[model samples]
Target: MTVIKNAELTAGNSFTQNQALGLLTELVPVSLNNINGREIQTTSAKKLHAYLGVGRDFSNWIKGRIEEYGFIYEQDYINFDSPNLANQSTESVQIKQWKTKRGGDRRSKDYCISLGMAKELAMVERNEQGRAVRRYFIQCEERLQHIAPQDVRKLRDQLKARITAANDFKPMCAALELARAEQGKLTQAHHYTSESNMIARLVLGGLTAKRWATGNGISGDPRNSMSADQLKHLSYLEQSNITLIELGWDYHQRKTELTRLSQRHLAKQLEVAND
Candidate 1:
């Protein structure tokens, strides 16, 4: 593209596997019962620590954190009869030694540090925990001296290769992109002498405001960095095909008409979309 002025706000941090899984579950609650948000499989709970970008034993680290929250007490498989024994057996515990639950989806695998971190991960629906085997991406550099780096390096290489491969955005913007694609008929990409271009010489068309209250992400999408009303106004500008001229709209307008199109509107008409 022609460098559309940063086009988007700064991209946030990369997700770890657990974070991705959590986000995926949060984003697609129905999918949690399935796999990859589709009719894959329910038996296999996804491993998310790798998608979250953390060191090896991160699950243990997270579980450790969850344990630290004070509510989650690791009741040793102790013999209540022999209370002196610090460790207990699985057979004796019903609630697994009486632990106060801290932060965790029903399943420990899906749990992450924040409930509002990302869409699929933070969604409330996927917050269920079922006992299952989970996987994590272990970093090679974090390996202890005595451990082998064979699998760690392999995972690192695979993840590096997947960084670009996995960028395939989900269906979130698919509908909008389809709508925009349909608009392409009206918006001829290039027209040397077309009247659409002819009109461009005179009219400034439309605009929302000078400063954008919420400058990033979808309106009403909690994952978005900006507020719904702000995105809604920008959507209006995008719809009107005019420069929205946001608060810090690139520190330049390139032309006076582009500048003059700026106008403020009440932050109303906000609507929540499918999470």
Candidate 2:
């Protein structure tokens, strides 16, 4: 992608993983092809030290830089607790970890740097690598600027999906209202609301819809806060509840049946996630 003109430097500090790798390769000849994802850049501390030309005292220097720049661990850089040993030959693993050291038993796997941390390092370290990093970041920022329109479109599509999910919940609410009207009881109305809360908790990972929305930094009805997959799960439960009510099941029977099924389904999902 061609770089856009007049892009802001500050905007370069939030690159996706692909963008970071592209820029890194442009600056240096090293290949960091082992990592996966859109938000992480993993390389050895030794590699970073060599590139920065900071000599053999890189451990202390990096520690000092992190403190001086107020870098947040995991956000700016992740010092992995366990070394990544997946798919490595025995000799290569030994060679890779030969000069790497850590404070405790944890071997140095790699330093996972975010775009923000990389930008700070480029600015703080005055050397050839620093200049190259600065130029690469500028180009990356310019390319991101060119994709602004696509980002806006993606956001709009997401908002539309959220709205559709919110609308889907209205039928369930209406069906419960009808059940209350047929029984002509205030208790039935309250029971349906309680049951809805239970279902929300089951499918939405333990929070009531409103609480989930607030916790996720969203506003408005929590039902609208669900992803498409979550909406599908909730819709299935709601439709089952509506079907049971239509077949003349009382509130107590519907509650007992739905509660048992929801709990079992949630358990299965949890089991799969753990595996």
Candidate 3:
């Protein structure tokens, strides 16, 4: 039999876990663990035990619960004691060695129970903390269920298509600007170059497209490296520039208007995110 040392199991600190925690209730932190190429929502058994204020030793309590409920290994929970941990990333399962009462280092037996197992365990406890945590788990499940992974992927693909379509209009607008310059006898090769630089500067914080690509070590357009939000904002600015060009606004006038528009759009975005 393996001796279960009294040590706290560290919660996952990965970005996915942190982001989920921020969105869900933080009463009991959860993690997304990769098992056999699939991600599972799990929580630390030790943390759950501590949160429940159980009177029995953690090892005995967990073992008794598993045996009593007939919880299957690797299906309901995962034990970190196995040598298989060598194949996993540290971020996936955070395990740490601790000093024992005898001043010796030992790795504790840590278990990560699935959300289903966790809810069942909490329900069996029949206490206020258990009830509260069970409800929290239910809420987390409902929220996650609303945004399935496939749905998110589909939405992202749609956004990419929209951005690409928006990009195609920019060149057409540039040709319109060239024609307008010719009619006004202000035709200059540098006009098109300056207009492109202005859009890059407005969207990328003063970095020209070439400068941004070089700075990020990108071989092509820097838009490919931009976040979804940045790309959407870039699309909006491009359309705005196209309109200003049609309205016969000079380069300096359009630059001033675009700067103000970008600032206002960013402020609105921040406000909406906060709300």
Query: Which is the leading candidate under TM-score?
Result: 3
lDDT tens digits, residue span 1-105, model 1? 011111121235353335543444442222112111111112111133333332445446444544554321111110112111212233333344322233222
lDDT per residue (tens digit) for residues 1-275 in model 3: 11112132224424343333343354467867843223567887877776777779778999999999998675577787622222122233333633344444445576888888999998998765576567768766666667576644544654594576367556645665676766775646676667767777876878987798788666534554555666667777777877777777776888899899999888999999999
By TM-score, how accurate is candidate 2?
Answer: 0.36
Error of 2 at 158 (Å): 6.5
What's model 3's overall lDDT? 0.67
The Cα local distance difference test for each model comes to 0.28, 0.58, 0.67
Off by over 4 Å in 3: 1-172, 175-189
lDDT ranking, high to low: 3, 2, 1
Question: Candidate 2: lDDT of 207?
Answer: 81
TM-score per model over all chains: 0.20, 0.36, 0.41
